[model samples]
Target: MASAIKRSRTSFLTALSLGLLSFGISSCNGAWRQRIGIEKQPVAEPLPEVSDGPRSAPLKPGDNVIVEAVDRVGPAVVRIDTLKRVASPLGNLFGGRAPIQKQAGQGSGFITRSDGLIFTNAHVVEGADQVSVTLPDGRSFSGRVLGGDPLTDVAVVRVVADKLPVAPLGNSNDLKPGEWAIAIGNPLGLNNTVTAGIISAVDRTNAVGEGQRVPYIQTDAAVNPGNSGGPLINASGQVIGINTAIRQAPGAGLSFAIPINLAKRIAQQIISTGQASHPFIGVRLQSLTPQLAKEINATIDLCKVPELNGVLVIEVVENSPAAEAGIKPCDLIRDVNGTEVKDPSQVQLAVDRGRVGEAMPIVVERDGERLTLNVTPEELPRQQ
Candidate 1:
């Protein structure tokens, strides 16, 4: 009986030992599998919920003026394409008939009236045998040049279209420097390109090119090769100026535009008479300077003359209005039509406001005496 009991105890101990070793081997395998990423660990509980706080108000439609202005005026901008005939160099070498080649050019313009009247730069359609206008909707039409003023670089083109979108004209005289200026045009053949900048200056004269009497609005906007004649809009989506010339050369950021006030006047004249006219005084005038005043005072001895701040006449054309009115060289123009004159532009503006055949009363200080002279201005002769 004692031996059987001892065998039973030994068997029980062996069975317990076998159970413990099996559990240890299973645990070791599980650890190795976990370390090697062959088995996934138990997932942890989720984190507590947290709030991000209250949301702010949504943005208003008027928050973005640029986008609004573009949406308002962009459709009025048009692309102008011109084709001109050019003589081919190879024609001379071939000893054949002078070869005629079609030269294609592209520019920009804006509709000024709902009757399909468009305003653009004169140089855009100058010498073009054919002109084509393309709207933002991809519709193209053949355009006819109504009139062009090469002096102001303004031109009017008409298209036979109804219900055309017209850009609203603004008072350019009310424009102040540092205001927002938006330029929309096809630049470098890229249609509907928009650029933003500030009005760098106003009344910029003689900065664009020679013989431009109208004061130009200078801006830093990216007015490129194809942006000419496009509208330069204000923040209210009003057309303030017509983009015209860019300062060409390296480091070029200076861009100029014809003021809308002057453009409107010229366009009106062109529409009414099929030609624009400018008032001519028939004299070469120079702005008076301190040195020039001293030199004149020394030479002419114009005693009792008040502080000189006026334009000095350099030369007068023969049989011209200035010559007929006895306006000679070295005469200082003090006022025009009772308006005090300070610069040549002021005088120009006064003369521009007068009728071609109307008498213009001009005050000149000569030999220490201020003399009033009545001169009748004539229309400037058109260039041949």
Candidate 2:
């Protein structure tokens, strides 16, 4: 009986050792596969050398012309910093994570008037419990939220400072594609960082499905996260537009600026009523495509009415100016008040320049016939 028991115990020991050896072999195979064939790490490229010395680009004589623009506008540009306690997710032993508190955010701005009136994007200072502005002269001041226009993403703030530098407004209508555009602002907390680029495009109302009526000028300038509300200036040192948006991602050479003419319009309204008076026409217009133009008038290749004309109306808002003036959806509007509308923007521009209760004549083509409709413009209610 004892001999039999000893034999059984030896057999069990032999099986255990074999099992352990098999496990070790399997583990070694996995490690070898990882090291030899399966795993390949990406090669890291060397970073670009950043010089510690004063990095200055070789300037041409024409570049010196911008010196005055920089010097004159530099003082008005202000730095904006914000702090807010935000909830952060913390590691947890259980499946549920704990909430941790953290402070976050960044931005820029500029003084618009001497009595502390400031200009900036609504998003920059929105929800900021405490707002502060720092001048180039190292003078810090408290900012008051005068009002904000979310449609245009423009906001006004006032700082109680004496003798503030106000930037002179310029006509954005004069800006052309390829014109020099200088942007001066605090980007990424680097105060007074100036970037230069050209006017890539104009009247670019590239709306991202947003229902707002504000049009934006698109540029290829290297505007980044913190450039909102900065000025896009021309060579004459006039602000052509307000820097507002960039591409949804980093690399797309697309940046958008609110037209300075539009900004001036909003700013004037805000300064007067603490809000913007957005102009509206009660008609939805669609560009007259060739096919549609042919459908409306078989003979007229280019629909030109006697009074005012250009875009073909698709719909008139209920009780809107066009509707009240008996304007139909199929009517092709070729002119407004004496200005002939060549495009949708030109129509908008004419309507935008006109005030509520002002009467203007719009020429249209209906069934190969030309007719004039008198429209008494109405104030489009301020969007909430």
Candidate 3:
């Protein structure tokens, strides 16, 4: 009986040793938690209950304006996740692609009207198979793409929720260099990242691209791939621009935004009508300097112009309003509707401000002769 009791004690001690050994090995493996999630054990193995995030500290006097700005508008900003269907490269042995692969992408946006209307970039939700928007308050909803205008890179999204936060819109026209600028977005999958800078410049037309001119607001704020469609805020917490693109080359600090004024104009049209129309005169132009004038004089001949600093017409699309008005290449643009235009952006802006289908009077210098031509504006095509 004593020997049997000793054997029983020895067996119990061995089992306890093996259990400790197994637990130590599993604890050292860091990835174990990912595979083995928390399991509820009834009273036998109790785990500490996790608490929600800490409450925000109360606001005090003399707070930084940037902090105040974020506190006001951060709740309105949302993260937009998208899934796009793409063809898979590793398909059947026949060298064909499979169409079942889904690619994930992310961006950011803000509420504008509070009735579920959100403004984002067209490239964010465009052609997406699925869109999901996550608010800052830990609520999410399936997003609907109401309308998207790729020409202006603006899109409107809708979600069904009550008491949505809205970011107030500001006049981008009133923005000037050196004003405080703030950026908030989900960059590199990190949500609600905030960065601050100043308005580096405004009315930057060439920042978007070579041909597609949008007067972008340039800022030094940090913007990344996932930061697209986020808001660029002013000192008063008003949204001045939509964070769009960043320079890929040297001076990588330069980031660009679509002016909120232009965005609102497009958004209003998309909300009311199914699409937005851009009035264009159908002419490509370059700002003429003395050096550029010299190049034109020595290059292929369409028309000759006196050496001057003004907007130089480069190409006129066939059957367009400019061609119909007899505005030819190498013609130096002097004025649009009697207002002198110093650059190509100003010329485009004047035409946009004027009524479409109405005759716009323009003056150009051709071979030392100033000629006035009347051209009617027309709606730009989607691909334009």
lDDT of 1 by residue, 56-167 (tens): 2222358798888887788889999999999887876757767888899999999877778898999999989999999999989999998888878899999999787777
TM-score of 3: 0.77
Better of 2 and 3 by lDDT: 3
Which ten residues in a row are the worst by lDDT in model 1?
12-21
Worst 10 residues of 2 by lDDT: 12-21
Q: What are the Cα lDDT values of the candidates?
A: 0.76, 0.66, 0.75
Regarding TM-score, does 1 or 2 come out ahead? 1
- Residue 161 C-alpha lDDT in model 1: 91
| Residue clash pairs of candidate 1 | none
RMSD to true structure for each model, in Å: 40.3, 29.8, 29.0
lDDT of 2 by residue, 352-378 (tens): 666666567777778677787777776
TM-score of 1: 0.79
Ranking by lDDT: 1, 3, 2
The deviation in Å at residue 307 for candidate 2 is 20
lDDT score of residue 262 within candidate 1: 84
